[model samples]
Target: MTRMFRDPVFGLDADVVRRSVENVAPPGAATDIVDLFARAAWSGIAEPGDSTAGFLVSAVGASAALAMLVERWSADRIVRESMVDVDTAAFATQLDRALVRWLPRLDSRSTVRQLTLAATCRAVLVTPEHPSWPERLDDLGPHAPLALWLRGRTDALRDTAHSVALVGARAATGYGEHVAMEAGSGLADRGFVIVSGAAYGIDGMAHRAALASQSTTVAFLAGGVDRPYPSGHSNLIGRIIDTGAVVSEVPCGGAPSKWRFLQRNRLIAAVGDATIVLEAGWRSGSLNTAGHAAALGRPLGAVPGPITSAASAGCHRLIREYGAVCVTTVDEMAELAGMSPGETNEDAAARSSEETRVLDALSVRSPRSPGDIATRSGLPVGTVQSVLGLLELGDLVAEKPEGWVFVPQRP
Candidate 1:
């Protein structure tokens, strides 16, 4: 049953809620107040990359989906009402799993409260229906954001035709920061928007250089646009909001967790035409962004530092092992942005087939045995054994007491 509440308790009749957020709704959108309210609610309820919320909003309207959850509808009822069916029972499996996750977050009061807070912060909501929503985000397909909570000029997101993502180690060396600055200003002067997560080290340097070049830049955050994370970058983030944009998939007040930071990487890779790893240690989170770009089949580039620098070890791993093109100058990066394709067929022709798969199975955060890696990579244990031997010899991988781990080359 469809229902509307006009309770004297919160006294939030639909019109009253609509009037409160009227200014930030995307101009010319249908803007039924409930839809605006639901998007805000969904941002808070689901963590970034929540497929169930993404799919539901894409299928049913955001308003109806939010209403179903707010009413505490059953999983079966949700599937029946929203039509989230798929072949061979996949839809049933997805919906069943989703119910377990979504049930705990069904409070409508929290949604209303978050919306009220966002209004006070002057944050804006941009759904796919908005004129400013970047179409490149649709490349994520079902994984596209439900809505983006933004604190800067929404118009800056309108054209991402010339955007490049510059990411690297948070604890960057002076060499890394210098390269990032040069790449940022050079790319910006050549007419590209600089995009990076607003972390310290390389990301901060990139944004600053883009600003110095007088170019539009954007920060894709792991937390709420309203929250300045690293708390150190508060001033830099404010500068971005004034000049470019700060965007997030999470609503106002959401905290940046480790998992959210990992999830936020995909957005950075997807929005930019190409991604540059100015520097990263072997286990640097920046590699996560490079992995996403490679998975999306977008061009990826890495800068080379002296062999002595541990900070650039990840870049070496990407180039020598995973086939990332070595980009020494902004012109090469421009080529990646579309003047030329990244690595040539010859570079690909040179890779040992097992190298990429074995590397993929290994994680920077944990260790895995050769047998376990075979399972993740779907290769025979014998083949994994041979590749691990080769990788170990190259110092691309290390053996720990627990198992083998991907690590930086020790000086």
Candidate 2:
């Protein structure tokens, strides 16, 4: 006997619901097809981090709560039916506001399309009921995601007990990129799954280093997992999908917005065991991720940079004012994530302070002479020459007929 989910407000074919979820849903988990469909609908109906929707779904099952909405049940009636032990007046006010936000997105066809698109993209839909769902997200309380749309290994979410989120400004500097690479590869070698937004700069470098180390990584997107945002990282996101996971609270085919990106930070903070800000400017969006980590009581670390560099101002701010631990090496980061100290290559015969300063002074494009490098780096001309020789030996810098220019390293 085929079961059809029909209501006055919307109708769903049970076969379509089952087909959409069969491959993604774990065996012997969430056999109720209607409930799964309702959860998928809620993912599109509510924006990321909608507390009212979270409260409703938690108070009642997703199906019943969605039923009340579709049926146009009054706020008072819903409170009575759900038997929630809250003050009627206060709860009703919240429900009324939530209704205003939710009702417009209650179309059944849109949800069906989302499910179809997800199926076509081979994306997995993970609800709270799924065994592989990350329980750490429950700490988010009412702001937690109602469901997750994933591409790639779904087990990555379950295995996040040792995940570390490496986040920073999209406009990362050479110094920041270098640090991100070290942190990403080092942490991965120590068995920590790297987590990031998959944006350009620090985030992309971190993911690449983790991939280079042949370790698992996870990227949380602000938009649909089907449509990778920033378009530029589409190829990078595809690579992440090969071994890692790309996640989103939004369903398939949705576009990224500023508000969605801000809300997405909370998931990165919650999903990772700890959060590290590699490099950020004064108003960098990565600070938003740090704030969420603080609120959730997750360990937060910041990498300090040269005081003269404005790119690291957010990290400095976090260490000085927000009580974020100052982390300079991969071991320090691992310790911040509650791992004991381990042997690391961070202290190896790497770039010296002079080398770093000279490298920073030289641009990839406009070349600079030794005198100009010394002036810009505030090092002696003789010292700059010595450091440049060492850097040239490492193939980090090359002297053109014009002057010395930085040779960017590929991850």
Candidate 3:
């Protein structure tokens, strides 16, 4: 039987899409580009960490899964008819709900758009079959992304097998930023690729320090690689694409939301060999990433900050409550993450554990309270006014609306 080989969208030969995939295909990726295309479609259809998406793709195939969604098959029919070989009872339980969540977003154009957008953005979709695919992510089991939508150096992802994730608050303070910079630069110097979500504050500082140290860094975005999140970091993200990679589970044109951000944190935790909360507030989202790392059995690190700082409270909580290793210096972070001796960063700066640099951030000229200060500084503010009075004595700044302004220094 002569099977017709064609892409339903372009009505051209299926090989047309296959050739397009080759633009970003690494040396060891799946040779069949059509299957790669299917995975890309499904990536957009399902949200990140959708186990049902993983199960469907695993039981059948990306192409067949796409076909199931395309044809609008019912959950009962899919389990009874298509997934006949599998254990139906358990899979069917959640199958209906999964379809409900997935079907509303199901637009054929959505999948087609991912391919066209990938070509325009010079992006690649890497599946488990790909040689450069980070094998460690498979440890996520059914929660693994259906496939990765990537831009930048595909080779950089392989480093994820031995990478460290440094994540913390976006409203970082001078102290927190300094530690993040030191930690990021120091870890990158140690030959470990840095992994993070490219948000402002801690995540941004980590990415910057990694690049400054001339080490590769990969960022996982909550949205499509085509549309980077926090839009403020466009230039920073652009720089990353030139050297490392920006990856996402969602397809092109997808906007980021609150749920996606939380889900994206899991990828950050999963992609790294270890995860460290450089500085986090009590309710900071970085703590969420820390939770995933702990759950995944990845070594977790919490950098200690001032005892009074609410910014580092999350880190303190982790150290005290979650059993996260206390990682003060870069060496400790490396040791905590189990960095191989051979992976040492030769030109790493000669800095001791006790040495801490203050990475000052000039906040917007508005009255911010001590809590806000700690959030920005990665320090905790004392609930007592005496602490502010002490700094006032030091001539740091006269208080205005309970906020502070730097006092001019004596020459």
Q: Pick the candidate with the highest lDDT.
A: 2
Q: Candidate 1: misplaced stretches above 4 Å?
A: 1-12, 28-30, 340-411
The 10 consecutive residues of candidate 3 with the worst lDDT sum are 353-362
* Cα lDDT of model 3 by residue, 1-411, tens digit: 111234553233555566666665655544766677677768877888888888878777777776777677888777976644666877787788899888887765556666788878988888888778888788788888888888999888877766899999999999999999999998887788999999999999999999999889999999989997889999999999999999988877778888989988988899886799999999999999999999988789999999999999999999999999887877667755643222353311332211111112112234566666556445545522344565467454467865754443332
**CA shift at 18, candidate 3, in angstroms?**
4.2
Worst 10 residues of 1 by lDDT: 339-348
- Model 1 misses residue 8 by how many Å? 10
Q: Model 1 compared with the native: what TM-score?
A: 0.78
Query: Which residue pairs collide, candidate 1?
Result: none
Candidate no. 3 TM-score: 0.78
Q: Write the per-residue lDDT of candidate 2 for residues 294-354, one digit (tens) a residue.
A: 9988889999999999999999999999999899988778766644345222321255667
Off by over 4 Å in 2: 1-9, 23-30, 343-411
lDDT of 1 by residue, 152-246 (tens): 78888874545899999999999999999999998887678899999999999999999998888999999888899879999999999998999
- Tell me the deviation in Å of residue 206 in model 2: 0.6
Please, what is the whole-model Cα lDDT of each candidate in the order they appear?
0.80, 0.86, 0.77
